[model samples]
Target: MSASLSVGARDLPRTAARRVADGLALAAAPTFALMAILVGAGGSDVGQMLCAGEQGLQIGGMTVMYMLMSVFHLTPWLRLIQSGKREAA
Candidate 1:
């Protein structure tokens, strides 16, 4: 009975988190598209942006930074998922 009651209590928070996730997912596409359009319009030698002597590469910097930041952003969701799996077991 308590477990079922707790499940009912969990639904509101889960629904709120789902809404936040949906919002971020929805926002991602337009943000990416705008960035792509701006980058495309501002034409440079995109190839040379990541060459042997081009300070390692513009893209390389962005990739490094994104990965570094993603760890912090993704860790919470990973823990949440793991906990859900544990609960199922």
Candidate 2:
């Protein structure tokens, strides 16, 4: 009916936003995984150049930065998973 149609119309934007977030989350997992691998494999030269100006952090600041960024980007995935769990329950 018109009310259901109206409800669907209102949900359009929210659905689109969820799609976007899901897409980003999909990309983020692989991206952070690759970055973690590269960093763990001693690929922080680029990161060091960008962050430490050739001096570099004695404690691997670049790796820490990437770790923080990866965690930050994990929000969407976490929310998606929680929502899925709730729906399942």
Candidate 3:
């Protein structure tokens, strides 16, 4: 039925959006975990590298990666919020 087809058509984007959010969550989780570990456990190493005039590129890279993933993961949630559509129960 066209009505049913229309229903499904409308749902497709939301399904895709949810899937995208889920995927981003997976990627963001490990990124933040690694970031916490690097910052917390590797603090001394990072500090030493900085004090020694080294660029500490690894730490900087991790920070950048973490921020990027967090932003990506947050995007779906922001869109969902802005759309004013309540998630299906």
Candidate 4:
């Protein structure tokens, strides 16, 4: 029907937006985790090498920032897991 088609057309953008948001939610955790791992492992030496001429730059800052980002991004994953548990129960 024309009315159904119109409704579906209106929902198309909303559905696309939801999918995009879900994709970002799924992507954020692993992206931040990888960043944190890389920064925590050998970031100090890499930072020193990169900023050889800079003064008083703390390499730990980047590691901490990435760690915080990873922590913050875990919320989406936690919510996802909670939803899964709810469905199972």
Candidate 5:
């Protein structure tokens, strides 16, 4: 039982890391597409403003989402560490 539990625990972090990486890739795709379009459109002032605003929002939103997801992914580890410290105390 302890061995199985240890194996499960080891798998958990790797699975969570894969999920976070997948999520980052998913989040980045649209941002990259938008950037490509913006670049191809030739930075006329109007085009620049429009694309800049749109890309800014998209990238910023993705950045925030990534940060939140990262925090969420770390939460379990953090809790485990804190609990360990408490137990040690």
Candidate 6:
């Protein structure tokens, strides 16, 4: 028996954490866009409009970042599972 070879249950909590993080990031863009649009439509001052725009951009960036992370995390797990099934066949 090889000492380094072992199989155990997957870390479900970690997977859930990653999924939640990804979801939050995905949601950030729309949330920010809505906020900016609402604020702009409310007839606020120039400063407020600028602030909202900047915030919207930041939120969109965060959303992209998180979505990328989600893809990265999910891809590997899916590949691993597929490979295992292929090997078993």
The TM-score values for the models, in the order shown, are 0.41, 0.53, 0.44, 0.75, 0.42, 0.40
Taking the tens digit of each residue's C-alpha lDDT, what string does model 2 give over 1-89? 99999999999999999989779777886687567656755655677666776643333666667777788788777887899999999
**What TM-score number comes out for model 5?**
0.42
Task: List ranges where model 4 is wrong by over 4 Å.
Answer: 46-59
Task: Count clashing residue pairs per candidate.
Answer: 0, 0, 0, 0, 0, 0
Q: Please, what are the lDDT tens digits per residue for candidate 5 over residues 1-89?
A: 99999999999999999989766655554555555445434434566667667433333444455545555455455655798999999
Instruction: Give the backbone clash total of model 4.
Output: 0
Candidate 2 clashing pairs?
none
lDDT of model 3 at residue 66?
Answer: 72
User: In candidate 4, which residue pairs get closer than 3 Å at backbone N, Cα or C atoms, i.e. clash?
Assistant: none
The TM-score between candidate 1 and the true structure equals 0.41
Please estimate how well model 5 matches the true structure, expressed as its whole-model Cα lDDT: 0.61
Query: Looking at model 2, how many pairs of residues clash?
Result: 0
> Worst lDDT window (10 residues) for model 2?
54-63
Q: Ranking by TM-score, best first?
A: 4, 2, 3, 5, 1, 6
Model 1 alpha-carbon drift over 4 Å, by segment = 1-5, 43-89
lDDT of 3 by residue, 12-75 (tens): 9999999896877656756675675566445557567768876533445666667566666665
What lDDT tens digits, residue by residue, belong to model 6 across residues 1-89?
34333321245667788989767665555555555545444534569668667433333444555545555445445655798999999
lDDT of 1: 0.59
Put the candidates in lDDT order, highest first: 4, 2, 3, 5, 1, 6
Candidate scoring better on lDDT of 2 and 3 = 2
Is 5 or 6 the stronger prediction by TM-score?
5
Model 3 alpha-carbon drift over 4 Å, by segment? 41-89
